[model samples]
Target: MLTAQATSTAVSATDIAISLGLLVAVYAVLGLLWLFLVVREISHGPAPAPAGVVEEETLPLPSAGPLLRPAGGPMAGSGR
Candidate 1:
């Protein structure tokens, strides 16, 4: 009877250990999947800019214009 009880306890301990090992393995797989996704995204080039936006190199520089004025209001140099 004592030997049977010892055997049962040993089996229970082994089952607990196996369950813990399986849990760790599952978490490891999930972590690996997340790492793969991150690496895949990084490997791909950056996403395209939204519509109606011009690249910095293609943008035109500001041209000289009348100094200061609220649109159609008195100009800065001209007295109000």
Candidate 2:
């Protein structure tokens, strides 16, 4: 009977250890989940817009100003 009681106690202790281990594992998983959620929330914040610098727009057509016009062309200023 003593041996049987000793065996029961040893089995109960192992059971308790396993239970505590499972509890610790559960808490660890929950902690990781919380951390992941926080990181995800931070990452989800609006992404920074392409640097606030403004770009200048260029014209597709060539300038028709006097200096830019061909020297001997009619568009050189004397329309005649």
Candidate 3:
């Protein structure tokens, strides 16, 4: 099988170094921005809940009706 090789004139050390430097610079900038955003969020605390909302259920749930009935009552599914 034939193989491909880089010709000296086609790819120069200066070009490679420039691209590598640009890549590193881009990543470094993005990392700093992400870190800044995280620190800012941490400095702020959790938001407050809206007023007038009940902490617990004010009405019984439909499924709870069967369980909450008096024990002596006829069986739930019985025709009686």
Candidate 4:
């Protein structure tokens, strides 16, 4: 539909460039805002896991013993 009023006005190249520039600027601002919120939340850190899931009695650790041989075992260096 051609309206007499609409046909009379002309759009310029500068107007189109400005519109695109403004669109990019708006998107950039939104991206930066999203990044900032993400960084702030990451700085706050992960939430602590629920304590109820894990409950165990602490037992004394087993004492360390010889790595390889018992007292009666044959020595490793001896030719067999």
Candidate that would win on lDDT? 1
lDDT of 2 by residue, 35-57 (tens): 99999989899665588644445
The lDDT of model 3 is 0.77
- lDDT by residue for model 1 (4-58), tens: 5566554577798899999999999999999999999999968999999889999
> Where is model 4 more than 4 Å wrong at Cα?
1-11, 51-80
Q: What TM-score, over all chains together, does every model reach? A: 0.47, 0.41, 0.48, 0.45
- Residue 53, model 4: lDDT of 54
lDDT of 3 by residue, 11-62 (tens): 7889989999999999999999999999988888666558976656575567
- The lDDT for every candidate, in the order shown, is 0.80, 0.76, 0.77, 0.75
Question: What's the ranking of the predictions by lDDT, best on top?
Answer: 1, 3, 2, 4
The best candidate by TM-score is 3
Cα error, residue 76 of model 1, in Å, equals 32
Candidate 4, residues 18-74, lDDT tens digits: the string is 999999999999999999999999999978659765434555444754535655666
What is candidate 1's CA lDDT for residue 53?
A: 84
